[model samples]
Target chain A: MDARSLSIDGLPVPFDDGQTIMDASLAAGIFIPHLCHHPQFTPQGSCKLCTVRANGRYVSACTMPASEGMEVESNTPELNDKRRTMLQMLFVEGNHFCPSCEKSGDCLLQALAYELEMLGPHFPQFYPDRPVDASHPDVLLDFNRCILCELCVRASRDVDGKSVFALSGRGIGKHLIVNAESGRLADTDFSLADKAAHVCPVGVIIAKRRGFAVPIGQRRFDGEPISRRVDWLARRRADDEEEQ
Target chain B: MSNSEPSVRPATRRCLATTSLAGCFGCHMALLDIDERLFELIERVDIDRSPLTDIKRCGRCDIGLVEGGICNAENVHVLREFRRQCKLLVAVGACAINGGLPAQRNHLDLGQCLQEVYLTGPGIVHGQVPDDPELPLPLDKVHPVHEVVRVDYFIPGCPPSGDALWKFITDLLDGRTPRLGHPLLHFD
Candidate 1:
C-alpha cells in the first residue's frame, strides 16, 4: 500500500495512491484545522482554513493530492496565524452567541476560536439584521447565526433532494436563504426530516422541540473542543480504513 | 429477456450513482449510516461519482440519487449531468425535492441583501460591486432540482433515516416500485 511518501512539517509520511494531503496528514497524526472538509463528504476546498505550505507553496490540504517526496508544512507559525485570523474574521462576521447556542459545547468554530486563544473578535461585528423563521413546526432557521459555509445548502440540495436552503447574497454579507414564495418553512414542504437541519455546523438551524433534550451536563461531545473531535474522527477513520 | 419463461435468474440489479448539490453530505452519509446494509449495497450495485468516491461524473447509471437544491449554474449543470446519465433519477433528500433552507432568501430581494452587507454595513468596501458574469447570478427565486429536470423518484426527510433509505433501496433493487407512504419518506 506504499504508493507514495511525503514529508509534512519535517515528519516523513507514507500515503496510498490517490490519497489527499489532508488524509495523508491525518494518517500521519498531523493536525490540520478545517470546517468544510469532512471525511464523509466530498473534499470541498470551501473553507480556506486548512491552507498549508506544500512544497513551499500554499495549497489546501483537503483537496490537494499527495505525491512522492513532496514537502509540506502544516502547522507553521505563519500558517497558524493566518488560520487564527481567518477564524476571527468568521467570528466577527456572524453573531455567534456561544452561551445561547444549542451547539455551543459541541460547535467546531467555537472550539477552534478557543484553541487559537481568540479572546475577542478584532473586526467590527456584522450584527446582521436577519430574521428567524420558526414557521415550520419541527425546525427553526436563525439567519443571524449562519456562517454561509454552504453545508446546510449542500445537504438540503444533495442529500434531502428538497432544495430547501440556499445562500442569498454574495461575499461577506451573504446569508442563508429558504423558499421564496413561502417565506415560512411550513409554507414550503420543509419538515423535521430534512438533511439541511444536520448540515448546520452552528446553531443557525435547530430541531424545534429537540433542543435541551440532553441536560447541559450530559450533552454528547460536550466540553470537548473541535480539534479533539477531529482527532477522534481521524482515529475512527483510520480504524475504518484499516478494516476495509 | 424472456417475458414468461420460468428461468431462475435474479432480477436485473441496477447500479445507482449519486451526486450532491448545495446541501451537506448529510443525506449521502445517512445512506452509509445503514451500516451493515452499506456493505451489502456496494456488493449489489456500482456506486459512481458519489462524494465517497472522488468520481465527478458517470455515464448510463441505472439510478441517479441527487440531493440538495439547484441555486447556481454549477448545480444546474450537475443536475443535468445526472439526468443524462441516469435512467431513473431519484431526488433523495428534502433539499433536492423541495428547495430546503437556501430557498428562505427567496422571500427577500437580492438588492436588499447587497445593501445590508456592503453599503450599509459598518465596514467600508472601497470598490463598486464587481459584475462578474461567471458567478451564478442569484435567481429571483430559489428552485428545487426536480423543477429543472424531471425526477422519477423522491425520498424526503430532514435527513432521512438510514432505515428509510435502506427500505427504499432494497425495494428498488428488488424491482419493486418503492412505495413511500410513510410520513417520513414522502408527504402528500
Candidate 2:
C-alpha cells in the first residue's frame, strides 16, 4: 500500500513511477480489457478497448501513465457499452464468421465480446472480398478475419525481425499486407515458427492443417473465462517476481 | 395492512412459438436440450407452433424464436408469418443471425451450383434441375433472417447452448433484459 497510488473504480492501487495505467492495473491483478497492448510489445493504443476515465477524462490506459491520487474509472456501464459497440464495429468491419472460424474459441475479440455480453454483431456485415493466403506451406493468412490490431505487424518487425507484415490504406479501408513484392505469403520468408504467426489476436494467421485439433469444448476460453485467465497470469507473474 | 384485502391471482403464462426455416433444426434441438428444466419453463410459458409440439402453424404468441437463414421462397413466407404472429421475434443460432453454412455457397453463382449438383456432378441418374410450381424457388443468395425482416433479438452460435436459450427465455419471462455472459456465450 504505497502512499502514491491512483484509485481505479474507488480501489487504491500503487504504480511504478513510469508505469502506464494498464501496466499498473495488470500488476495489481486488475484485468482491463485490451487487444493491441500486449506486455511484450510497446503500447500502440490502436485498439481503444482499454480506454478508461482518468480524473474525468477518457484516455487509453495502455498509453496514459498512472498518476498519484488520480480517480480512474474502469468497468463502468457507459464504458462497457462503448466497448460493446466497438466490438460490434470490429465484427462487421471484417468477415468474422465466428461459428466457422478456426480461432473462434481462442480469439480475444470473440472472448471479449462474450465477456461483455455482446448478443450479436449489432452492425450490418461488410462481407469484404479479402483474399486468403494459403501460399505458405505451413501457414495460412486469412485476411477476412483480420481486425487490424497490428499485433502481427508489430511482432514481425519488433520481435521476429522479418518485417513480413504491414498495415496498408486508412480508416475503414485499412488492412494487413505482406512485405514481399509478390504480395503473397509464400514469397515472404515467414515460417510457421515466426513470432508474428503466433501473435495474432484473431483468426487471421493460422498453422495449416492444424485447425480444430484441440477440439471445440477443450479449447482456450472454453472452460474458464478470459478475465479469470488474465488474473491468473498476473498472479503467477507476481509470484515469480517475489521469488526473484 | 387490512386482513380483508383482495386475493391476488397469478398472471397467465406467456405463450411462445418457434420455427426453423432453412436450418438443420439444431437450434430447436438446443432448446429441447434444456432437458428436465423445460418442465420448470412449461410452468411459466405455453409453447405453440414449435417442433416439440409438431404444430404446423403459429397462433398468436408473445415471443417467437426463429432459426435458420432464408434460402428459398418458402422460408421467406414462414419467416414473415412468424413476424406477423408474434409480439417479439428472436433470431436464434448462426443460420438465423447470419447466413451460416448455407451462405458458403453464396460465393458461387446459384446457376453454377445447381449445374454442379445436378447435371455435372458425379453419379447422377437422369440429371435435371427440377422446376415445379409446387416447389419453392431458390433465392439468388442465402440471406440471414434479419436481412429479410426486423429481428428483435439475435442469439449467435452454430446453435446457441441449451443454458443460453434457457437463461434468455427466463430473463425475458422475468421482464429482465436478456444477455449471454462468458462460459455461456460461444459462437462455435
Candidate 3:
C-alpha cells in the first residue's frame, strides 16, 4: 500500500496513492461537506458540495485524486459560500418541512445547512408536487424530502445488488423512481434490510413505526455536530482495526 | 450657572414593532416566551406596533419583526408598510422566512383549497365560499416575507425559540451581527 501525504486547508492528510481527495480527508478525520459521495459506493460526484480548489483549479473532492505536494483548499469562505448557495437551491427545490419531518434532527441535508449557517432558502420555493408512496409496510417514501443525491440508487446497485431506485428525467423534471414495473416499493423486493433503505440521508426513505423513537433532542447530530461525529467514527474505526 | 441650565437628555428608547400575517401566532407566542427578558427588552426599547401592544398601525420604528408568510393581499400591504417604516426588518420564523406549512397549499389549486375549506368541509353550515369585498383576497400562492420586501435579517425556525429571539435582539442593540448557528438555528 503506497501512501502519500496531501494538505487540505493547511492540514497534512496521508492518503493511499489512488485515493480521492474526499477519501483522504475523511480518513484523516476532516469533514468535507457532501451529499452524494458515500464511502461504500463508487464516487459519483453528483452533489458539488464537496468541491475544493486544488492548485487553483476547482474540482469535486470526491472524484479528484489526492496528489503529494498539491495545495487543496476546502474550508475557505468563498468555497463555503458557494456550498451555501447550493444548499439554498436544494432547500427551495424540494419541500423540506423540517419541523414536521420525522428525520429532522438526523437528516444530513438539514445538518449541513445548519453547519454552513444558511439563514434561509435564498431561492424562491419551487414547491413541486412530488408524491409520497407509503405502499411498503416497512418503509415510507416521502419524495418531498428527497434532494436527489442518488445514494439509494448507487447503494442498491453496488452494495445490495438490488437496483431498487434510479433517477428518471432531466433538469427540473428529474426525480427518483421506483425500479419495479408497477412503480411501487411493495412491488419490488425492497425490504427494510436493504442497503438502499438505510442510505437515504434525508426523510425520504424512512422506516415506518419508528418515528421519533430516539426523541427530538437525542438524535445522532443533536448533541454533537456532524463533523465531530465523523471524526469520532474515524477514530472508533481506527481503534477497532488496531484491536483486530 | 447650574440653576438656569435646561436638562439635555434626549428620549432614546429604540422603537420595535411586530406583526403576524398568514401563519399561526406561534412565533408571536415565542416572542412572548422571552418571559422575564421582556422587562429588559422594554427598558432598552419601546413597543410601537405588536400583538402584545394591540397597536393597529406600525409607526416609524428602529426594528420590525415580521412572522408568517404572505397568503393574502393584506399581508403584502402590511409587509410593504413594515419595510417602509422600519430601519431594520427581521423575518422571525420559518413561515416568514420560507413559507413553512401554509406554503404546502401551493401544491394544490387555490380554488380547490377554498372549496374544501368553505363548501365541502365536514362542519360547513353556509356551504359557500365567502364573497365579502371587505375581506382581503388570497394570493395565488403563499410567499415568504423576503419575496414581498427586503428583510434585513432572518431567524429560521418553525417558531424560533425564545432564547434565540432574545439573543438576536440584544445582539442588534449591542451593535453586533446576530450569529445563528447549530443550537439556535433549528428549522424544526
DockQ of each: 0.01, 0.57, 0.78
Better of 2 and 3 by DockQ: 3
Per-residue C-alpha lDDT of model 2 across residues B72-184, encoded as one tens digit per residue: 99999999999999999999998887677887676678999999999999999899998988999999888888888888998878899999999999889989998877777
Candidate 3's residue-wise lDDT over A42-153, tens digit each? 8889889999999999999999998987889999999999999999999999999988899988888988998999888877888889989999999999999888889889
Task: Report the number of the highest-TM-score candidate.
Answer: 3
Off by over 4 Å in 1: A217-222, A234-244, B1-188
Interface RMSD, every prediction, one decimal place: 18.0, 1.7, 1.1
**Candidate 2 TM-score, C-alpha based:** 0.89
Residue-wise lDDT of candidate 1 within B44-138, one digit each (tens)? 88787778888877878888888887777778888899999989888877566556666556557778876776677677667355468887665
Worst 10 residues of 1 chain B by lDDT: B179-188
lDDT of 3 by residue, B1-188 (tens): 56876866544679999999988999999988999998888888989889999998999999999999999999999999999999999998999988989998999999999999999989788797888999999999999988889889999888899988988998898888988766887888
Q: Candidate 1 local accuracy as lDDT?
A: 0.71
Clashing residue pairs, backbone N/CA/C < 3 A, model 2 = none
Q: Of the true interface contacts, what fraction does each candidate have?
A: 0.00, 0.63, 0.87
Model 1 TM-score (B-chain only): 0.82
Per-prediction TM-score? 0.52, 0.89, 0.94
Better DockQ candidate (1, 2)? 2
User: Could you tell me the lDDT of residue A155 within candidate 1?
Assistant: 70
The true-structure Cα RMSD of candidate 3 reads 3.4
